[model samples]
Target: MTQPILVIKDMSIVFSSPDEADIEAVRQVDLTLTPGKTLALVGESGCGKSVTARAVLRLLDRNANIPRGSILFQPEGEAATDIARLKQDSLPLRAIRGNQISMIFQEPMSSLSPVHTIGDQIDEMMILHEGLRPKQARERTVALLDQVGIPGARQRADAYPFELSGGLRQRAMIAMALACTPQLLIADEPTTALDVTTQAQILDLLRQLQSDFGMAMLFITHDLGVVAEIADEVAVMYLGDVVEQGSVYDVFARPSHPYTQALMSSIPKMARKAERVRLSPIKGTVPAPKDRPVGCAFTSRCPYAFEPCATIRPERTEVGGGHHARCHLLTRQPVEAVA
Candidate 1:
């Protein structure tokens, strides 16, 4: 759509260890993000959400591997570049890492330096990318702190990660990520481990700031409720593959995949005294990435599965209006839909 700001084409990622067979962390996944829009990648742990996000930034650990993929980044004024092809720690990639693209990791407490003050931490990125002197960086850091709703910006900037509450630390992380005004932000569950109220506040802050900065976001989260609250588009992953992708409204209101239907039914909803709604949990666990089925990886857990589901991987088929699902059931139209 509109020559997406970021387009991932047939991307795959793997993790290899000397003693073990290669584990496919990500399959032939494809995703796109237009400018100023948010795409939520939601799935259970090991569904390759984080790995895919990390691949965009070239931030995976040493053991991780990518046999093939192309992450085409089309920053406004520049020619499109394949971030997946660029060397991870090279100069060009480095410039894009925190300059054009920044990330707010899941655990600021662990990701943030234990040795530095919050102000210094935020200042580092600006200094590195914007070439700001200490004084200017500090001044802007204070401003960003205030903008992100961290009270007493001046004094709190001097505090350490341990000194601030979980929420405040997350705010500081956001401030730091915004220091360079990146074109895209990959937020790896930034609200994880926070209270519900705090999560809502952080989500609100993220939406406000993303709008203000006009940056695309790849929001990796497992909470469908949160997806409804913030996402414009959503990609549902299972066992290293994206089984469904579409507008949040379309996907949530009319889920096509059996996996997606099961996921939707599991969302806890509010009900009155006479309207008790029991959650329909999916039947089985996700298969191990290293030894998943050659066919639809979801067949082991899918309820409407048929013979082909166990032998051939279903290609993505359109349900309606840009909504697609990779389930064989999509072929048997009037047969049976998940209850």
Candidate 2:
């Protein structure tokens, strides 16, 4: 098999409060993104999906620190380099951020500068990462907007982000992320706030762009429907850890972890004609970072929890080829009820 474009081995991120207590926001998570594939990090809000993505780009604030593990990146034909250990000032990872790896955030209004015109915003990265001259960068920027399906690209380039509609702003953000033609794109719920039709367009645009670029994608979303549309693989997260991970087909069809099953069951389905569809919500709220559970962070809400599950954390065990789940029930029964 070809080497992966990015490899995250046992990556952990912790936040230290003024009282000196450490809160693990991400715990020993491992993931890989190969060329021409998409990995969806799915979970409820505050489950550390976004934290994990930000850690890969070293975009975490000073309050957060990487406690363990490494994030390795291998450019198409280059030697593997450890991005986690690189100095902030001398980060060679910059070469990957916009040139080889890029990110499209949830809110375009907040992510794109209000002061900068759409064209200037996209051109800035090209200038910095690709070293393109001003005029050349502008030309590419216009093409990028058009490529993302934004009509009247040349005229819109001169407009400010606030002046554009939600969908247009998002398309502009996608254009900016693709300006450097990155090999890996991290999208953090890029369609969270858009209308349904706009969301569909954005997702289709992303899919089309992924095919055209053949870039690996780490797409973070809470919507299972969106995952079904674009993900080749799925990693279900809870609290600070991945509870289940496998091919999109297997994980969605036969979810092993209680959390994974609950999340899938919660999605509103269309085929069923029952008076009311059953919604299995994982009980209880996500525990505060400062007060995480001792064993499985999801133990409080898991229906299959036993004494061992509450006291001893389960390591990720292979359930099948490329399918793994962190749960004690897998040890007891081949299949068990999640709710």
Q: What is the C-alpha lDDT profile of model 2 across 1-339, one tens digit per residue?
A: 866899999999998888867888999999999888999999999999999998888888889899799898883456777778877756576776767888989898766999999999999999998889999999999989999988899999999998999899999988988988898999999999999999999999999999999999999999999999999999999988998999999998899998888887787777875757776666788888667777888888888788788778898989899999999888765556789
Q: Tell me the spans in candidate 1 whose CA falls farther than 4 Å from its real position.
A: 75-78, 272-274, 333-339
Candidate closest to the true structure, highest lDDT? 1
Model 1 weakest lDDT span, ten residues long: 268-277
Candidate 1 residue 115 Cα shift, in angstroms, is 1.0
What are the TM-scores, per candidate, against the unseen true structure? Answer: 0.95, 0.94
Report model 2's TM-score to 2 decimal places. 0.94
User: How many clashing pairs per prediction, in order?
Assistant: 0, 0
Q: Rate the local accuracy (lDDT) of all candidates.
A: 0.89, 0.88
| lDDT tens per residue, model 1, 219-241 | 99999998999999999999899
Question: Cα-based RMSD of the predictions, in order?
Answer: 3.0, 3.3
